[model samples]
Target: MNAAATTHHHTSCLRCGRKLTSTKSVATGYGPTCTRKVKAAAKAEVVAQYKPHQVAKAEELIEQGGLIPLRGQIYLAVSSDGSQTYKTHRAACSCPAGIKGLHPCKHRIAAHILSLAA
Candidate 1:
């Protein structure tokens, strides 16, 4: 038996239970139409929806040394392991949480705050 065949990949869409046909749909568990809908909805969500509490958390982490401000408008927020560096800009970040779904992530908010203070 093939390893991929036994990997328990999605056979149907989780949202509507539609039978998955294409390989990409099977892998994502959502067909192109539904995927487009989801992406549209997500893109419509404004960055401000990230909430003030989440911004506070980002600030707290910065205070705790998880984020370090570098030269110019750039800042580096270290991951939990303190090994990987995530570059944060005034309105964006290199982190997945910053780019995925919504454009501005918590790291971006923190960077914005720092920018305003400066």
Candidate 2:
């Protein structure tokens, strides 16, 4: 059997436990409205967890395609200077700020955001 045919889908929305009638909803395990609300809440949580500047820089890096995935959970992020790159991971980054453990650097934040989206 095909993978899609073998897969088991939920009959209720995963978020609200509402009955799911549509094929797409069942497959995704969330209703359309619940999907939007869940996404918004996740975005809000990310924003609240990080500094505004760090979030902004991470968004910029994503928009610019400046983060390059390397091995597992590792990425190369372009430095603010645009001339250098730093090794970035969800837990650690090679940037100066990260090295000092002051706070999560933009590179590390960007890697984390990308992983969430993926």
Candidate 3:
């Protein structure tokens, strides 16, 4: 057992912050799984963006089957009142609650859930 060979640098992946398992991962600054996610997210497409709390709400909505994914960035949200609200990222909503800006609405939350699922 050579003492000089015992040391290792616990480098973390830049994307997922997981411990880099390979010398290549440490050099590249990303793990394999996170590298794929980062590349997919970097594509010229609408990625469902969400804050931490919004993701939490989206998780619940997804479990309840209240979120439906439409084409592209569009999604349909089934509200508690049984009315359907269309949520397009940064677009209008049919529901009275409305969806706009950075505010988190049920429809918007559902759309986010759909985005993550797709």
**Taking the tens digit of each residue's C-alpha lDDT, what string does model 2 give over 84-116?**
677999799988898998888878877777666
lDDT of 3 by residue, 1-118 (tens): 5322232233875334578888766655456675455335323232345555655554455444444445566655555544444454435455566633446565665454344333
Question: How many residue pairs of model 1 clash at the backbone?
Answer: 0
TM-score of every prediction relative to native: 0.51, 0.61, 0.41
Over 1-118, each residue of candidate 1 has an lDDT whose tens digit, in order, gives 4321232346776445689898877765556775555444433442355575766665554444454546687877765444466888867788878768364666776566555443
* Most lDDT-accurate candidate: 2
Give the lDDT of residue 94 in candidate 1: 83
The Cα local distance difference test for each model comes to 0.58, 0.69, 0.49
For candidate 2, the lDDT comes to 0.69
- How many steric clashes between backbone atoms does each model show? 0, 0, 0
lDDT of 3 at 69: 41
Candidate 2: segments with Cα more than 4 A from true spot:
1-44
Candidate 3 wrongly placed segments (more than 4 Å): 1-54, 90-92, 99-102
